[model samples]
Target chain A: MRILIIEDDQVLAAGLKVGLGLAGMTVDLVGSCAQAGEALATTAFDAVVLDLMLPDGSGLDVLRGMRQRKDRTPVLLLTALDEVADRVKGLDLGADDYCGKPFDLDELAARVRAIGRRGGGRAAPCLTAAGIALEPSTLSATLNGQPLALSRREFAVLALLMEHPGAIRSKGEIEDRLYGWGEEVESNAVEVHVHHLRAKLGREKIETVRGLGYRVQVAP
Target chain B: MSSLRRRLFAILVAATGIIWLCGILWIFVGAKAELEHVLDTRLQEAARMVDSLVAQNGPAFAAAASAAATPERYQRQLSCQIWSLDGRLLARSGSAPDVSLSDHAAGFSDRRIQGEYWRVYTIDNPAKGVRVLIGDRLGQRDQLAVDLVKGLSIPAILMLPLLGGLLWLSLGRGLRPLLAMAVELKAREADDMRPLQTQHAPAELLPLAAALNNLFAKVETARRHERDVTAFAAHELRTPLAGLKTHAQIAMAAGDPGVRQEALRHILLSVDRATRLVRQLLTLAKLESGLAAGQSERVCVGDLIEEIGAAAQPSGKDVAVRIDPALRDFTLTANRDSLAIALRNLHENALQHSPEGGAVVWNVTPDGRGIGVEDEGPGMPPEEISQATQRFFRGKRQTPTGCGLGLAIVEAVLREMGGRLVLENREGGQGLRAIAVLPPATSPCP
Candidate 1:
């Protein structure tokens, strides 16, 4: 999952980025309301972690702007204001979830994944197709009841493909989900990760069409 | 008498008792004077009647007077006597002593006869060769006045207790509103700071009720301030703690040694920030409690500055501090701890706000009434300068680690020491210069 954190505290923002990044989510950070608006307009994120008190204005303004634009990106409010009223107001403003400060990093990651899964219209905790199962919570995959060892990048690539088995994901869309801002992306990074995925998950699961993008199909 | 009701009651009762006493005295004096006049008139009448009897009934009246005959009604109150022209014993009533009633031999006179005091009236009849005397006892007149005073006193003495009771009851009725107010105050909960009802208060108690309500309002405002400070402190402390927790968690989970090193460093920074905030809060609390209050000591400005400057510097920034040499020997007679806290905050603020490797200049003001700290960095906007000292008021250019309490503490400390804080932009608009303007009394040491 790709996530954007709108927070003004530099130390906390850095900590959240590294922590969420290790959990197999590409995390980008913006320190003010203006920057958040710009990032939201330019990029698509799977989920948003918002801090209510920003330098220029409140994070609620950012959430309101997104909802007004009919952008249904899952927003999990992460703020220092843990009061019940603060939570209620954020949730009522189209937030998908609320997490107060000093929260457990594991719990935060799980909540983000939950909201992202729900936003994708999936009810199950894991994605399964054709004897292959992916558990987003543990970032683990199983093939025919055997556990498979995959790098974090390789896992992210496979998760994106397995979300909709028969739906095509263009190269650009996959790259957006895999890399955060300021992280160096190699020219063939997607191609290399997909090649590695094929060697492990079987090539018949994935198909490429000329002048289009990559897609995966479940066995009949 | 300290109680208003009791005092008023006492005054009223005393005044009434005095009036009653005066009334009885007036009646006693008037009755005594009237009794004397009537007795004198009766004596003259009785003397004249006997004189005429002696003239008409001649020898027979002499024989009657010798028998000492008197009217029944006047027997004890008055006496009659008859005497010949020669000095001789006169006929006397049973109540009168046997002696000449008067040597003058005519008209009203007072006489003492045979150890008895008498008021006597005498009539002379030279042609008839006889004298008549009427006498009354002085003791009898005194008894009548005493009896008359006694008649008026008995009822007056009896009414005293009733009068006192009525006064006390009426006084209590008049002061019931005050007692009700006291009862309402006593029954109130300690945390209930509501104002007392003034609309229904009595006219006399209006000032008291208004003053009490004003006091309650002040206390409520103070309590609200305390609550807000507590809430703000909790809110401020949570963010740093959250940062510490997140960084610690990241350090524990990082696989690469470089990432682990960076995370550990962040954890340390978070601890430092939280520690600073806690220490600042403690200092503010101490200032509020007035600990070491009003104890001023002569402190050398140069030594104090050197001690603080030698202490911890802002990590990773090498801001230079230039203290004017003229201030080295300067001293101030002020509260040592408060001055230290204020100067330390000012120094830290300047260092934190100064650009990397920039210089912070410390100097005395030209008027010799203040100290100045100038930093070479982005000064605050003019509109924000006034609100800069408000608690937790971070401006548009708030720093990441600032808790927004530095200027506020400085302002509080200065105010406690009878001084003020003056914030303004530097001359060229390159930075800000903060001045600690001391009162005239605390200008400098000789």
Candidate 2:
């Protein structure tokens, strides 16, 4: 799992990235909203850890811009303001979760994971399908008691699909989930990934809905 | 000297001195005028008497005048001088020196004889055609006037000081009540806000006393409210903070991951409880101080309840909310933040007291005035109901997780909004029913 942290407090951001990296997730830290936007445009992250107060502008504006562009990448808002109005405003603006400052590092990690899992469309913390177990934090996927070697994109696609087991995700939502703010996308990018995933796994591992989207059905 | 009595006495003394001075001036002026008029009249009377004697005795009048001119044998307080027609000094009173009255024709004249002012009258008798002049010394007239003034002024001057002293004493006596009030005030502590005793106060100060009492009543109430809020905050935060510290320490010391996780969970729960307590404490303080009264907004009861239910569900309690369909869209003018705090506290209290997995129902009904939250938990004892509203007052049946400030916060909000909180047992004797009744909104939309 790739996580992006947008926080002005370099010390706290560094501490969080180190802690989360120790938990086996790749982490990238950005100190301002501009840097966050630039990073998002360039890289693909599983989740974005956004701080409400940024050096350039508010993290809410970034979140709102992301949502407006149909980017449903999980976003967790971190803030020092513990007022209820601020909480409501953050959540109402589509932040998956919020944690106030002076928070325990463990709690922040837990909340981030929770929002990440939810935004990935997974209901449970652990993802399992067809005797395959994938741990998002470890970014490791195993099939039939054997681990599979997969590229970053393949792993991301598998994770997104397995997160929502039966839910039909539109092509656009899948594209949004797969890409960050301004990543370039080929016309048949999802199709190419689906074909490749089929070639790697079983033919029926992933199903595509014509003119709508894709769904990862439960194995019968 | 700062006392009102002393001040009033001083004022009265000054006024009396002024009036006494004016009276003395008036008496002095009147005595001087009266003396001058009397001296002139006496001189004219003496001249008339001498002229009649001269006419009766003819040429022998001069000799007779000399015999009658004795100042020591006068009928009234008068002195006389007589001169012949040729302006020669003839007969003179012993008080008068040998000097001609005047060379002028017979009339009345004022002359300085021997450096003394004298009123002299000269009479021309038509029968004798002799200018008979009779003069009386003005000194005698002025002496009489001075004597009269002395008789009047001596007693008046002496009484002025006596009158001033009496005025000073009376003014001091009249202002004793004010002095007593000052003494009482000076003796009290700065923090003392008790009402002043109205006994012995003057009628003029009654309104001032009443205003002071009113101010004291308000101040006392405000002070009591502040104390209650502080005590509640301290009491409520103590246990949860201690628990948080303990759990954090345990988690830090634990070697096993499972033990550490469990300790972390406990720490989190403690932290959550502490946060809730702090929020409630702030809400209670705001409500008690009436700080939120001016910031009231229109809040929809249904939406508010839904939000509270969502927040309450995280406690893992079986919390249910049932809004009367008839009252679904009802709105009220209240401080939304404070109202939310109050409703959340009630929900928390219910969740705590209800058996695990037991239903904690939040029923919102339109009590003629406003919305009411009726909880179903183990209701408090009848005697403890009133005490529960007080800060830091915990009932025997209260849950260990509670900070005993839930009902107190509710009470404070209700009071700040000019509302009331009623606690009673549920109909089935199942649990407590806490109702927060607010004033009816001026307008309601269904």
Candidate 3:
């Protein structure tokens, strides 16, 4: 899942970036509402972790702006204001979830994954396409009931393709999902990851159309 | 006497009882004098009647006067006597004493007859050569005066208890508002800061009620301020703690030694930031507690600056700190601890805002009333200058790591030491200048 964190605290923001990245999510960070709005306008994210307090303005303004623009990316509010009223106000403002500050890293990651999964229109925790299954929670995969080892990038590429079977995802979209802002993208990194994914899942499992993109084949 | 009702009731009842007693005494004295006069007049009338009868009916009538009856109303009260001009006793009534009532020829006199006091009136008929006397006992006149006094006083004495009861009840009715106010206050919850009702209060208690309500309002404002500070402190502490926990988790999970080292460094940074925030909060709390400046001492500005500079230099920002030579040996009488806190906050604020290799300059004000700290950083907007000293008030140029308590603590400490903080943009328009203005009465130590 690709996630964006909007927080003013640099140390906490950095820590969250590192922590969530290790949890198998591509995490991006913006420190203010203005930066967050710019990032959201440019790139599509699976989920948003928003801090209510920001140096520029409240995080709710960002959420309100996003919802007003008909953007439905899932948002998880993180704040030090643990009052019931604060929580209710945040949730009523189109927030998908709320987490108070000083929270456990594992729990935050799970909630992010849950909201991200819901945004993709999936009810199950695992993604299955063309006889290969991927468990996003554990970042592990299986082909025809046999466990298969995959690198994090390879797994991310396969998961994007398999989210909706037979749906074509362009190279730019896959690269956007694999990397966040300021993360360097090497030449043809997506093509390399896709090439490795096909080798593990069988070449017929993923199809590349002429001058378009790649997609996971649907089971017959 | 402390109770208003008791005091008023006592005063009223005592005044009324004293007046009643005075009235009874006046009646007793006045009645005694008037009774004596009336009895004397009756004696004279009786004496004249006997004399006239002696003259009209001659000696035979006079001889029958001893058996003749006195007026029915005065039958036992009056006594009469008749005697010839030769000083011999002529006739005496049955109730009269047998001795001569008086030796005077023809006037009223008081005489003791047969060891009994009498008020007598004498009439002499010159043509007939006889004297007639009528007398009344003085003791009986005194008894009538006593009866008059007893009649007036018995009712007054009996009415005292009833008067006291009425006074007590009336006083209670008059003071009902005070009691109601007490009950209202007593029944209030400790956190209830609502004002006391004053609109319908009695005129006498209006000032007291208004004062108590004012006190309640002030307490409520103070309590609200305390709650806000607590909330802001909790909010400030959470961010650093969250960073610490997240970084610790990163340090534990990372497989690469470089990432682990980076995570450990972040953990240390988080701990330091948290420690600084906690210390700042404690200093702010202590200043807010209204502790008066304690034990003034002579502090050299040069030494104080040097000490803070040494402690703060570890940040390694490469900023140049220049202190005015005029303030090097200058000494001032102040509370050393609080003064240090104020100066330290100002110094930290200056260093934090200065650019790399920039200058932080310290100088005493030209007028000698205060000291100034200048930083080569973004000065605050003119509109935000007034609000800069408020707790948690971060300016538009606020850095992400700032907790916003620095200026607030400086202002509080300066205020406690009878001083103030004045913030302004530098004249050159490149940096900010903060001045801690000491009390006007303070003078540099010689």
Error of 3 at B30 (Å): 41
Clash number for candidate 1? 0
Residue A19 error, candidate 1, Å: 1.4
- TM-score top scorer: 3
lDDT tens string, model 1, B28-75? 889889989998998888788778877887766545453334556444
lDDT of each: 0.84, 0.70, 0.86
- Which ranges in model 3 have alpha carbons more than 4 Å from their true place? B1-231, B288-294, B382-387
Candidate 1 — what's its lDDT? 0.84
Predictions' DockQ, in order: 0.42, 0.01, 0.53
List native contact recovery per candidate, as a fraction of 1: 0.58, 0.00, 0.77
DockQ result, candidate 1: 0.42
**In angstroms, what RMSD does candidate 2 have relative to the true structure?**
22.7
- Model 1: interface root-mean-square deviation in Å: 1.7
Per candidate, chain B TM-score?
A: 0.71, 0.55, 0.71
Model 3 chain B worst lDDT window (10 residues): B61-70
For model 2, the stretches where C-alpha displacement exceeds 4 angstroms are A1-220, B1-12, B29-230, B241-272, B282-299, B314-321, B332-339, B346-369, B374-400, B407-446
